[model samples]
Target: MHNTRSSRGIQDLVDLFDCFIVDQFGVLHDGMRPYPGAVDALVMLKRAGKTILVLSNSGRRSAPNEQRLLRLGFQIGSWDYFLSSGEVAWKRLDRLLRERGGAEPLKCLLLARGGDRSAVEGLPLEIVDSGADADIVLLSGSMGDRFDMDHYRRLLEPAAARNVTCICTNPDKIMLTEVGPRFGAGRIAEVYAEMGAPVMRIGKPFPEIYQIAVEMLGHPPAIRTACVGDSIEHDIAGGRRAGLPTVLVGTGILDTLSRAEKAELFRRHGAAPDYFLPAFTW
Candidate 1:
């Protein structure tokens, strides 16, 4: 029997867990600004001596993401730590570069937001334009705010033909930005994967990123930690798979769904969260 509860906000978990792995975009902010009561929730949790790791599927590394959070008026320094998929991707890529014994710098076809190349900073990855000149394809994000799946498949066809491995930093199919939902790196990665290109996807719904989050929680037992996020496919499913309890923030991508609709959504995904929060506030 697991401790599954329905609650209004994070206040319900004050004494249930020592650590909280919070999602960024929908739970904390909507990409433009922090959610109401979100900062206060962090403050309340900190005052209660709970450890908070602001986990995100951001394509940018922790540093830039930290800076962005700070700019968004979050008390980032008070956080126990902030971890992003890009940070994990960099570590794994570093190891791959070392173990592969490549004589020259690894030429990479980088498809990312313009001026958002922090993930490969100080690494051996050399960004190239054409996939034909690459050892691997690095997808941090989509080139534009919106993209077509067919366009991506066609663009990646050359690389797939060459058997180039694609490393996707953020495995989110869509992002709930202030302007509304838009295609994310995960959607593009799907196109590549569908085209017979080997893809390594990091972020939510993947176990490695969860493992990193657990390790960051000081190797605490999975039962003692709760993953709070919005997406059922990414957060709830991933947390359950990683053996940690999940609390779905109802205000993210599923904000429009009614209770019954949300239940159906969970059922369709084949997983249900241990808890439900209308918002992430305390």
Candidate 2:
């Protein structure tokens, strides 16, 4: 990719793309609330005829965290559509049951935000509701982005011995949090794997959620549509796989990529986010 224009703010990048597919957790809200410029930037995008959707790992089995955003003062009611990792988890579970019959509803331990299951509210499954006596653990955001590695290890030891598989709801290892970058389910899932427990990850930058997000759009989005996010692994990789232009947010999980990391990504997947912004402005 050749140099187009260089900018650090969201407003500066708006003219670069017509549609914005933003990552929810890190790019907008951290945990306590929405960042200062998130709302205004998104509003600008909308007013400028940009169609935006929050693409999130939370969509695996449910809608994105609208209530969370509302609590952060983002007025999410106006931005009605979002794809979450929760929805992806639900679909993955659905496929597993169908492909492998007699696989009873998952005796699952959900590892996500408090309101993550909006899409899986009545779905048939024996969800253990994290910290419960679950046969398997569904991992993701830590109860609204508050998680500790020590706590996760304590929870997993016994389950590993019992032959429980940990289902990773979000594959991104770290995310931008109010306190700074912190671990995500992808990191926890890795620990589970090292312990010899089976693991499965659903949602982006995994492929499952991407397909669903595109479907929700009713048709393939226009070429001008942009997959905006912070991580090259989930957001950028998934967007490229879906054949969409990607917008890399400088303020998200992977903001401080090492030289080697950046080089590896380009050498392997050729990621060159069409636009880069420090925050979602414009």
Candidate 3:
């Protein structure tokens, strides 16, 4: 039973951990741009001799994310590494490729940003236009900003009927962007599951991505690692499930909620963070 308490900034809790698992979207940026002081926070952690991992649920692979962050004025080299759910998914896809040896590349139906194929750029996977030609369905993101579940149902139901296994790089149901909260790949995957297809989630709230981050931190004990993120269901709950200390940043998905409302939200979800802050900063 963890009681949610507020801290002035990330600096207040700096002494408690040697490694930081930082979420990108809410804590560092809001999709459209980086939050004020977020970049400085990274530099502060680096100066404090702490290992920082930008653990993000972004559907794009780390390379592209790094490039995007650099464009947004974040010092890319300040952190030890940037890890995204797409990279984790690519690993699994790579494994399947190794098992197939000399066979044809696995055909994949990709649902992602039109120009963003970084996740599968060098993989032994072939992007196909239709579900009928696909061996697996890869959902990197929503097709558009609408988040029309009914529209997705029409698209994914056919693939589900074909029993296509779907791998969702980002398991966030809603992306909290500056424009507004929009549907993510997770929601599309949900509809596929309802229509009877196996959905493999590769992001937060799941253990794989956290395991990778932990491994990169030289297998440190859980006590020395703290995960700071904005989403309770995805970040806090996921970190707690992975046995890492969790910190909830109120400036993201929970920005509009009051203290009491936040408490109720955590209770409703049956997950709580060790610490809470109004915003993530040094």
Candidate 4:
């Protein structure tokens, strides 16, 4: 059994680490606004001279995510760096395209929140109207708030049948919505994979993003850095894999689970956090 200690907030463990890699959604905010005390918690960290990296599984690039946080009342000096899965994936895609000598622009079908095209905004790829015409499907965000599983099935079936590759930048299985948590873009990518389409997921529970985040933080020792988030599968698992300490916040995904259920969840995932916070507070 894992010895996961329960704590009231980040205040109990501030000095243990010099850097914090924090998850944006669920832990810090719920898409629409910052969670109670979240902004203050960040301020506390900043005041303590902690290097904060606001990491996210968001499919939109870093600039938009940073802007959203600012609009939501988070001060600019609270975090040191901000990185998103979409930004990493975009960089990789750009590198690959350059490596290919700019032969031809690949036709891409982008699925994002509210028809947002920021994922492909500055890329050389052509945005195709239909999956049938796409050379690749960019699963950036979920329209789960607007559409259902069947909607995605019909949209991706044609591309899956043709064996078009899917690049899923955000691998979050569920997303926080105004109503509650709903299926995320990763779930849509899973559906495409179930349809026999090739999917390359880039985000939490994956090592690449962590590596980039660490580098952005000037390569702090793993022991001196902690990963904070609400999802065990993504945040906790990814942190463990990246050789950093993990802190699970009860304010987000696991907020509704009973104590016994949470124990079972840790057992099922076979990875547990080192500490648990009631919320993202100072």
Task: Estimate every model's Cα lDDT from 0 to 1.
Answer: 0.85, 0.69, 0.85, 0.91
- Candidate 2 lDDT at 51 equals 67
**Model 1, global lDDT:** 0.85
Global local distance difference test of model 2: 0.69
| Model 2 worst lDDT run, 10 consecutive residues | 1-10
Off by over 4 Å in 1: 1-4
RMSD of 2: 3.9
Among these predicted structures, which one has the highest lDDT? Answer: 4
Name the runs in model 2 displaced over 4 angstroms.
1-5, 8-16, 59-64, 76-80, 91-106, 113-120, 127-133, 143-148, 254-270
RMSD of 3: 1.7
Task: Give me the displacement of residue 98 in model 1, in angstroms.
Answer: 2.4
Clash totals for all candidate models? 0, 24, 0, 0
Runs in model 3 with CA error above 4 Å? 144-147
Which ten contiguous residues of candidate 3 have the minimum total lDDT?
Answer: 143-152
Question: Which of 2 and 3 is ahead in lDDT?
Answer: 3
Ranking by TM-score: 4, 3, 1, 2
Judging by lDDT, tell me the better candidate of 2 and 4: 4
Candidate 4, pairs of clashing residues? none
**Candidate 4 local Cα displacement, residue 245, angstroms:** 0.4
lDDT by residue (1-282, candidate 1, tens digit) is 134578877888887899999999889989889889998898889889989898999889988888988898988555789999999999888887888785789888888876687888888878888877888899998754656667677668889999899999989887875567888889888888888889999999899998888887888877889999998889889988999989988787888878788778788887788898889898
